[model samples]
Target chain A: MARFKFLVAALAAASLWAPGASATVLDNVKQRGVLNCGTDNTAPGFGYLNTKTGKIEGLDADFCRAMAAAVLGDASKVNFVIVTDKSRFNALQTGQADVVFAHTTVKPVRESAIGIDFLPINFYDGTGMMVKSASGVKSVAELDGATVCTTQGSGTEATLAAFVRARGFKTTKVLTFENLEKLFGALQSDRCNAMSTDKSALAAWRGNSGKPDDYTILPETLNKSPFAGFVIANDSRWRNLLRWATFALFQAEEWDINSANLADRMKDESAFVQKFLGAKDGFGKDFGVADDFVASMIKSVGNYGEIYDRNLGPKTPYFIDRAGTPNAMWTKGGAEYSPPWN
Target chain B: MTTLALRWVHRNLFAKPFDAALSLVIIPMLAWAVYAFAHWALVEAHWQVVGGSFKVLMTGIYPADQLWRAWFSVATLCAMFGAGLGLSVRPGRAASTVVALGVALTGVMVAVAIDVHSGMLAAGSAALGVAAWCGVHHLAADQRIVLSGLLAGVVAIFVVLSPPGFEVWGGLLLSVVLTIAVSILTLPFGILLALGRQSRITSLRVISTAYIETMRSVPLILVVYWIWIIVPLLAPDTSVPGLLRGMAGFALFFAAYVAEYVRSGLQAVPKGQIEAARSLAMSSWTLNVDIVLPQALRVVVPSLVGQILDIFNGATLVFIIGLTDFLRAGQMILADPQNSGRTYEIYVFLFAVYLAIGGAITYASRRLEAHLARGSR
Candidate 1:
């Protein structure tokens, strides 16, 4: 009897090695009835868990839901898998996630070496500096002789060094710490006159500070760091599905459609709006998804502006202004322009 | 009474002039630090963030409607724990009183801090605790029955929890489940490796030694990462759940350490006993099974308990593979910019919880060691 039990256990363990391969990610996701969307659980505004709601609610999280809505026709069919900055690409490559919307910056080396295709830039961020309001500094230009602190081994360190050199600030000093907590502490204790990092992170840190009003983020950005979703490289079917799903958010904003009025807009006489909503001659069928994918996605998550307003807009705690930035709509003279739907 | 207290204080704190001076300086600093911490924790800290986010901290993003599954899992665990305690060591009066006091304090704090709905769950847990105590005190069940019941409870927890799949497992629930699964799965493998290490066969000894040495030399995170990345590639058709892969990696890595511990226990067993059994015409299998294995396992129980605690603490590393455990859940809560200022309160709560759990395990292992020693003597 013991020998038989051992045999059974050995077979059971061996069965885990059996090949159960499936088709592409799209088909697997559809068959499984859920989209595994990778995101950062710790990134405020981009992706963070809303403790009160027992749900992940942020711009990147909303985009995950949007992708789920586009593919599965139910935005609630998304299971968020948290990915850290270092692990996001590996997650996609290993097929651990269907799509990653973890505020990854689009870089050439990432695409070429990491072998992952980036979607269109959804949130444009840049290296920026912050200073104490009482210090009487208004912009990066005025910090000529200031000492700046940033986290070590981050792109911000190199960016700060380049910014200081390019601006020809003779006495400006750059100090690096092992992590954000120490850098923030050094800045708070007057060890550094300024702190530099990604603008979004700076805003989040400022908002979390004891007195948010004591700090000011400079308007001048050092360099562009456009954030986007990414997927395993060379799978155009899966890649295009995610890319167009992101583009639909931008298009929905241009078409003046949002979650609140999606139902009414679905009945609009305009052929283009109807097509975009997948009501008439929709693109979902061509993309191997449901015809009403866009409409369902809109009803579930909302347009780009609504997602922004809900997560990072003035009403939210982060309160990052979108005006005069690439994040704003192109019609409003920003860089967020989508290709013509036709 | 005042004079007695003064004498006690003098002996403990100010017996010598140097001691008195050191006490004068350190006492005030310690008092001030304690006072400041208490003021911050009880009077000044915004505990509402913790209260509001308590559910997420306990079970991150677990569907709210299916929360009863988690509660049932907890109740089952309590019953299993009670049965194990009953089988191992009957609670003395002092131990019972301490447990009762701890439960009472926890219940009162839960009632004060949480809303009515959550308070009802706490009340239910308290009721289960009472029931567990009663069952243990009165049942007088057989050891095998209690062990089977505990095994059943583990199965029931998996059945109740796995319907949501491994992806939904998060927070403390994920941590506890992972630790339990890895510890249980590693035991048999560990024993096999230990036997192989001692085998006279060259091939078996060499392979076992190589595996144990290789696993022990690398960091655990690297093992988890390698398994997570390489396993899928090796069997692309087999879509193993990330949690299971992680557990497998953890078990495979820790089994080496467990094997070494068991090997020490094996060595500690008397050579005469094995020779006597062989002289009595007992086969190697019977000798090892009936005599050597039981005595070896008994000798290593305390170390095994310590390893269990280590695995529980090590479950925090799962977050590297994107599975949210207890520590990551706290980080998720702090990630909310709205609750950023409550970092101290949240971290304190996490620290207290880890300390409580780890301390309890250490205490239980010490008790078990004492009990085993008594039996041997």
Candidate 2:
């Protein structure tokens, strides 16, 4: 038995020393015929697991499928590698995952220190204040001497402090609660004049609070926390392909071409539309994907707006208004935009 | 009969004035709580959420077509469990009847609640278990055969399930597999550590003590997370599956505790037993394995069984490394916005399952302790 145990240990040790592959990530993904897309399972409307269908369904997960469609021409050729916030970057760095769409915030430090390059911002989250509509406090400026509440130990506390100092609010006191439930409770009980948190979380709290109309979220965002999918750093080949694939989603929305209208757009007589949709000419040569990779992606998951609506639209409980936020398309007055497809 | 019932109730619940008053105060409240729970469970709760995702709850994200592999693994496990039971002392007639009734109840529930195919597979597995028990119950109990059978069963389960990839293994299936693997693998590793700690060789004793103390001092989550991270770094080419790494972490951590339990058991064995074996010119290997281990193991069997529950509970921490064990699977289900309103229903279901499994483990440990004690008595 001792000899057996020693043999087992030796075998395990022997297996560890083999050299890693040197192929580019894109090439390896293509050869492997599947994409390992790291994402969270707990975050609702982002990378949640849909139990009824036994499939991962959310904006982040769909983005993974879109990447799979762009690369493998089959949306289902991707595996949802469940990752936590702590392990997400490690997963990408270790080659355990090819790309991660786990709603990670785009911070300069992360990009500078971590061996990962950020993709285009998919969702722009920021601290926002909420007040009871009955209070008639329309904006943060109106809360001159009012008490504000936020979850304790969160970044919002510091951000709120900065905002209060910057705005020169003389008597605006910030209160902290243990969690969002308690913070919202403090606001509801009038213990605080307003509640502050991420705009997305604020929207979710209001939507699920059973009295959404009674509360109003202020329009002013306290700080920027734009989220984006990312891949390992210095892999420009894979990085560019994923970057353009995400851009394709934005451009598809801009062109009003979704999964529903993609067929009709394919029949468009316009040379630019044809080329953009890969009907006449193609962009796949530079990207090293199929000529119709964008079309395939659209057909699989749809445009950015459609994907967003599918996960975070009014039909879902976590509805965050996309009309006025930076998450909206550039054709509107929001920050999401794509470069010229040509 | 009425007087007899009254006397029993009076003796048990109302022997003293204080006891009577306490019983009066508590009984109605307990009754009200039970009634309220029953009412909510029967009428208000949305059980459709649980019913609809039952497969996911049982085997998270395991491919639908490859479900037979999971079922095969389950059948293998059930057969192994039955064989183990058969190797033990046979239960009394009343106990057998109770077991039979429980099986029947489970069958009825499965038939009514599950799809026909799943129900059939479950029935087949149960049948296999009974057959295995009948095949071995009357024969002479052989520890060697049982151990070899368990090892074969473990190998068979992995052979059947690994084709679908280990990462996709989740839900209760993942929890059970991790517990079983950790429990079995920890035993020998722990015994070696215990023996090493007692070794006269100074280096072996020092190394064993350092490892055991270090593992016991740190948190299990840290070990699991680091192993998950470091294994890939150490073996950059070969990607070790996350489940295997998680299992390794669990085995490494629990082996320390097991070592402690076993070391105490080793101490409990009389020094005279070793001396007697040595006088008989027994080899060191035979002395330890035949004389010392059996006596030491009998003392520690109950504790070792209890450790199975510890391992099962600890398995839930695998979520940090992103493996969806049972509790994490429930969280995954709740993460869906559509099921957000059914939080209580999902949580209640998860609580009930954990309670049931934990209760069974405790009961089994008690039974084993009693069985082991029978010899001394």
Candidate 3:
């Protein structure tokens, strides 16, 4: 019995054996009837749950739902499983979720050591800090001798602690909460003077607090971990479909198309827009989907810019300015670029 | 009066300076725990946080409307509990006090878990019926208490379960319902498997032993995962929901463990007892039931209680296959931004809950072991 249990644990611990010889996650998901998509149901503007609708909303959730719509053709066809920072990889490798869009940052160890594969960067969020106006703490440097609250096992906590220590900021107390909500709550409740997290999340905390004016995200880009979607590695076919589906959302935005306007935009003189929308040619069929798959995804959700701004961009609650950040489109001199749909 | 109280403590805790020194260290830790619990339970913790979201505590992602099926289950269990104690085991004064403490704890839970929906009332009434029947049965044997109690329990569960298919069952209640239902469900199977293990027939022994060993060898999660994945594969026509698969997996896993324990008890029974009953010319059925089973069960009562505790703890593993219980509920609640900063608050609650339930199971097992020992003596 113990030997059998050891075998099971060894399989779990050695999760990086690559995918099985045949089949893709797409097949498993299709057979299962519902898309087992992972998401954070707390990170505002990324993947927070709406109390009223009880639905997970934000950029990452939108991508998960849109992928579900593209594949399953129903946005509601998803079983939105929640995973925390510490448990995301285990959830995916164990097959609890078919796709994880839980603000999962791409790293080599995760791909190699942890045994999972990364999709395109779904949400670009980097580490930043927040402090009250009264503290006169404008940059990371001013946080000397300060007690900061953040979550444990997160890259942000490590970076912050290192940055403070490197700067020789003595008396810097780092308190770790299991989630940012607690860390932010402790910040608001005066339990801790400053809270740190990804820039997107810091802005999210500010917006969702119902009193956004009191919080300020420091201008320092302390870390650059881009949140990417992922799945269990080895299913290249399904990986391709999901990867292309993502870039298509970005391609749609680049073509000045959206769920509301893609139908009319398909008739434009530019052959690229037409082919991309499947108006001139069926582009999506060979990927195990309909030719109008990108059209449907754009129709169900929207283009990349629409998704971002609606959730995290400047006009949204996170109020993140996309014009100057890496999150902006290539036309705007940013990394939010995708290849031609064909 | 206080000095005398101190003197009494000194005698028990400080017979020697070393003992007194141990008491000094232990007393402060216990005192701190008491102080912390008092402040949190009475002062700091948020009861107001529980609103219409009662299902969050009861069942993680368990569809809310079907909660009645789960509530009705409580009455069925209460009825069985009362019947079992009345028919065979007599709970001592300490046992009765502990049971009252459990009731008080439930009452406290009721006060907090007060968002009772429609079917909860019927479930509540069913419990009252069993309590009344037990009272009447204890008062007078002529009242037909046993039969009435069983009927009320069954009917209540039937009424509640019929509307909401068992799929919507959830929360700690789901775990309890599953533990009780699965333990009862596994009993006959475990017994049969145990008997098969002991049988002289070659094929039956091999098959039963293989079944027991295979199940005992794997973790409960693997069996549940296999059932979750394979049930659909083998029987495409049958679509068993996640919760049912979880229950079935639990039954399979627990049946193996229960069989081993039962087999141990069977092994321990004195050969003389069996021979004496056989010498009286009693049939195998009568000897098995009247003598062997009673003695074997008494020997294994503590072990059985311990098994129930194991089943309760193992129910949490069902989450890997996506059936949420209490711990999963904590994760789900922390998903909300309002409750996001409340991980410390929520996890603390979960630890306390498991500890409390586990402690109760341990207490009951100890009490039963003592009772069985005393009865034997």
Candidate maximizing lDDT: 2
Residue pairs in collision within model 3: A181-B341, A182-B341, B58-B171, B59-B171
What TM-scores does chain A show, candidate by candidate in order? 0.87, 0.89, 0.80
TM-score of chain B of each: 0.95, 0.96, 0.81
- When sorted by lDDT, best at the front, the candidate numbers are 2, 1, 3
On a 0 to 1 DockQ scale, where is model 3? Answer: 0.18
Which is the better candidate, 2 or 3, if ranked by DockQ?
2
- Measured over all alpha carbons after superposition, the RMSD of each candidate to the real structure, in angstroms, is 5.4, 5.1, 6.7
Give all candidates' CA lDDT scores. Answer: 0.84, 0.86, 0.73
Candidate 1 per-residue lDDT, tens place, B221-320, comes to 9999878877766676577888898999999999999999899999999999988998999987898889888899889988998898999999999888
TM-score (C-alpha) between model 1 and the true structure: 0.91
Every candidate's DockQ is 0.44, 0.41, 0.18
Off by over 4 Å in 2: A1-23, A129-149, A160-175, A181-195, A202-220, A267-270, B1-29, B120-136
Ten-residue segment with the worst summed lDDT in candidate 2 chain A? A12-21
Candidate 3 residue runs with Cα over 4 Å from true position: A1-52, A56-59, A81-98, A107-117, A125-134, A141-224, A231-237, A254-292, A305-325, A331-333, B1-44, B65-67, B74-170, B185-260, B275-291, B343-377
